[model samples]
Target: MNFHLLRLASMALIVGTLAACSTAPVSTVDPSPIPELLPHGARAGQPAVTAAPATFAKSRWLPVTWSEVPGFDSDTLHEAWNAWLKNCERPTPAFAGLCSEVRRLSIANGDEQRAWMQAKLQPYRVEASNGNADGLLTAYYEPQLDAARQQGNGYNVPLYRLPAGFGTRKPWYSRQQIDTLPEAQAALAGRAIAWLRDPVDALVLHIQGSGRLRLVEPNGQVRLVRVAYAGTNDQPYKSVGRWLLDQNLVRDATWPGISAWIAANPARVNEMLWSNPRYVFFREEPLEGLDAQFGPKGALGVALTPGRSIAVDRQSIPYGTPVWLSTPGPTVALNRMVFAQDTGSAILGAVRADYFTGWGQEAGDIAGRLKQNLRLWAFWPRHLTPGSASN
Candidate 1:
């Protein structure tokens, strides 16, 4: 799954396709097309395919037939039922009524699930205001790293909790200021939940938003813990990889490429780290029982399903909505059902999404290079009127 050549080749093809399409003639028809809606009980026997445009904060949704969704019949719908069930934990107002049926279908077969979806939902192609149906897809995952409860044994980089008066300060402190200033250091003095050996590993934890830590305590006991995102310094996120690319320090900006550059030039590590002013804080959570089997709680306040969950711009697609993701790729061909259960600072736009690839080193490797072209279709409740739900 971590094929660099495949990623590069696919990206090149996507870019070429985009370039060729850019010169094509534009359609004169209205971009935001409104269709007639049927009464709730009118479609008792068949699926409703036409509905008013589902308007959201930043995007529009036009109803389309289920057949229009690529790979609709091929995807293993039952595999995504777990994610759908998770969505029930914090169902959006528009989707609240369907939670019971969603729970009931957890044990159903793929055909049964697909049939239920067709009976209860309408498929809408997600689009921007200008009617662009294409966007970008990226991936993210949880990092699992070893750590020490106390600062010793070469574990100098500390993972801190939010400082006192964190909210009172407008922008808090920048990463460089936190690293160099005594006042900033004092504020976060005893906030360390664990200490990591490498600053780059700490950076990866911050960027990924959450991670599992193999903590070695004072009593010589070992345990696994999770550090979930609590807050940031309110500073903008700047990509260190982008910084390296801009400076011509590396041909590739992925983590592997960055790590190689770091190994070669250790002296300039601080310079590279400080390029991104934002610093994220975390709160520890126990990793046990069923929680250990699942990923971190997403923005929707539910555990995310690996390969079945996606982070989207809330303005475009509301949380709890089931999405059909399609991408023609040299990296990975994904035509499946995924749920909108998370949101990220970088995930913005009608069609753009960040696919959650689960945890561990293998997941990290896949996530780091998963940038490609994407198209999305939202499956919404048939009874709910489009443009009526509050995002």
Candidate 2:
């Protein structure tokens, strides 16, 4: 759901100081954690985000062809299918009827899957209400960092859990306020679930919303866990990168550029951190077994597929929808099937989308730098009211 700050996304957090964030405070957090050791089921106090209706999204759906979808026949269907299967976990009513058929086709070959998709689903080229057929496409990935169970040995940056009365507060505490205020510190006492070696990494975790933390316990043993989005202080997300750019502090504005600026202006790190004011709290989930291999669960409550999952404006393309994303750009030439399984704060607009490129360094590299023009076709089940699709 994010990429407005992908440059150092693995290390950066929050979107630009948008009008909302500019006037308001900055953001703080994201979703999912390991299930086996710390299953996020029936949690005692955690809140659930109730999704709203997508019927208000006004996008024209013009009939298209498989031929229009570049590389449609060549994509590894099995790879995309994994994401599709996850969507089935919480499919929209439109797709719920087709899950049985979807499961039956799970083991089919790429060619068969392609054929089945073409046979069963109708392609609707998604166009904006203004009749624009193209939009921007960016990338985001899961960040991995080393953390500690305690705040000693320079691992002082604390990743907190939700504090009491967090729901009652309009906006929790900003990065600076939280760090400087005694009451804020007192509220967060005993709530530090984990600690990170670098404050920047903690910032990255906050920026990315969720992260994979390889934590070192007091026993000198290391274990991996997902410190996922528990809740934010409810502050609007403000981009630290954008703040740096507006101040003429960084010219490149990418992750590497931010890193250079941090190195050269080490004294200003807190300024950068506090400029956006948003802070994210996390829920620790164990990352052993199969959970270690997949990405954090998306808004759809499904494990996202690397390179095949996308975060969209749910208002435009509802969750569980399959989209044929074609974008010819310098950073990445992408023509593949992606599922709308996630949503982000910055991924607004009918034509906009954020591509999830999987985990680790390579995914992080692509997420930070890849931004391109996009054309998309959202496929729907054919039997839904044989009539014109309206914008």
Best by TM-score: 1
Worst 10 residues of 1 by lDDT: 17-26
Clashes of each: 0, 13
C-alpha TM-score for every candidate: 0.85, 0.84
lDDT string, candidate 2, 47-143, tens digits: 3212211223656555655555556765667767777888888877888888887888899888888888877877666778867777878777777
State the C-alpha lDDT per candidate: 0.75, 0.70
The best candidate in terms of lDDT: 1
After superposing all C-alphas onto the true structure, candidate 1 shows an RMSD in angstroms of 8.9
Task: Give the C-alpha miss distance for residue 226 in model 2, angstroms.
Answer: 0.2
Question: Where does candidate 1 stray beyond 4 Å?
Answer: 1-48
